[model samples]
Target: MSKYIDKQTELKQAMIALRQERSQIYDELKEQVYHTSEYLRPSSILMRTLKDFNKEPEYKTTVITSVTSIIGGYLSKKFLFGKSSSAIKKILGIGIQVFTAKLIAGKMTHH
Candidate 1:
């Protein structure tokens, strides 16, 4: 009867240690997730730049015109090439130009 009691006490202690270790691991994982989310939040620069662009009158018009031009160019290229690879190149070129223009405008206006 004494040996059985000793074995039960040992098992109880091991279970308690295992539960403590699990709790510690859970807390560590929670902390890591919190820190990671904080790091992923948008930077001040991006927010400020977006705010500045929103205040501009020409920004929206420029964006609209850029989009329209890309679409028009793509249609024209498709009509000209009739689904050839060259048409794809033209569409891609228009897309790249619009993207580059937006990036340049953003940088210029922000700075």
Candidate 2:
């Protein structure tokens, strides 16, 4: 009967230890979930992206190249088409603009 009592007491202690461990693990998981949610928020993501973009020189170069290409394309279209009212001429002008932009951007990248 005494041995039986000892075994029961040991089992109870083990159960208590297991419950404490489970609680600690649950709390840690909850904390991790909260942190992950904060990190994944849209504002957090946008801020991180902008920070990285500002820090990188390559992004600045890319932006400049893109803007210059677009302006060059616009100028070429205007110079060629003037103020034409023909739908066909307008469409052709747009095609020429795109071609000019691509060509300018490509040349800029190579040099």
Candidate 3:
């Protein structure tokens, strides 16, 4: 009867230890989940994407091409049809703008 009591006590202590370990593991998993959620947020994802983009070797060229393209497109429109109110002229102006932008961007990228 005494040996039975000792074995029961040992088993109880082991269960308590196991419960503590399980609780600790659960807490760790919860913390990891929280961190993962934070990382996956939209703003966080955008920031990470921007950071990766900035690290690329072509980042400077890409930025310059985009800025130059927009400027070139706007200037083409302004120069070709400044303050024109004709529907045909407006459509042609938009087409020229897109063409100019694409041309400038393509030339810049090739260089």
Candidate 4:
């Protein structure tokens, strides 16, 4: 056979190999895309979220801290300043201060 004929034969084989490889790559890509779509379905996403929730402490800490803080606030407000005569004296003092401020503002506006 001539050299030109052999070169043409080699080019044809190379082109055929390249086309097969391209088709294989396309099939692999399509398969991967289908698998990815299945992986991201709603049920799959929910399962993934549940898995992550089991692995994290966000919900636990949020519940514990929220209840503790609310109870602590109520208890402190009720117990810190108990119903004693001294507490009554403090409340009366605050009322006097507010009354004096209002009297002063009224006098200023009168001028």
Candidate 2: worst 10 consecutive residues by lDDT?
57-66
lDDT of each: 0.72, 0.96, 0.95, 0.69
lDDT by residue for model 4 over 35-84, one digit each (tens)? 99999999999998878867888765555555555555444444544444
Give the RMSD in angstroms, all C-alphas superposed, for model 1.
8.7
For every candidate, C-alpha RMSD to the true structure in Å = 8.7, 4.3, 4.0, 17.8
lDDT (10s digit) by residue, model 3, range 1-111: 999999999999999999999999999999999999999999999999889888996887898899999999999999989989999999999999999999999999888
Better of 3 and 4 by TM-score: 3
Off by over 4 Å in 1: 44-111
State the weakest 10-residue window (summed lDDT) of model 3: 52-61
What TM-score does structure 4 among the candidates reach? 0.49
lDDT of 1 by residue, 1-111 (tens): 999999999999999999999999999999999988776667755776678879997987677666665665555545545544576676766666566556655555564
lDDT of 3 at 108: 95
lDDT score for residue 62 of model 1: 74
The per-residue C-alpha lDDT of model 1 at residue 15 equals 100
In model 4, which regions exceed 4 Å deviation?
Answer: 60-111
Q: How would you encode candidate 2's per-residue C-alpha lDDT over 39-102 as one tens digit per residue?
A: 9999999999989989998998898889999999999999999888999999999999999999
Q: Candidate 3 — what's its lDDT?
A: 0.95
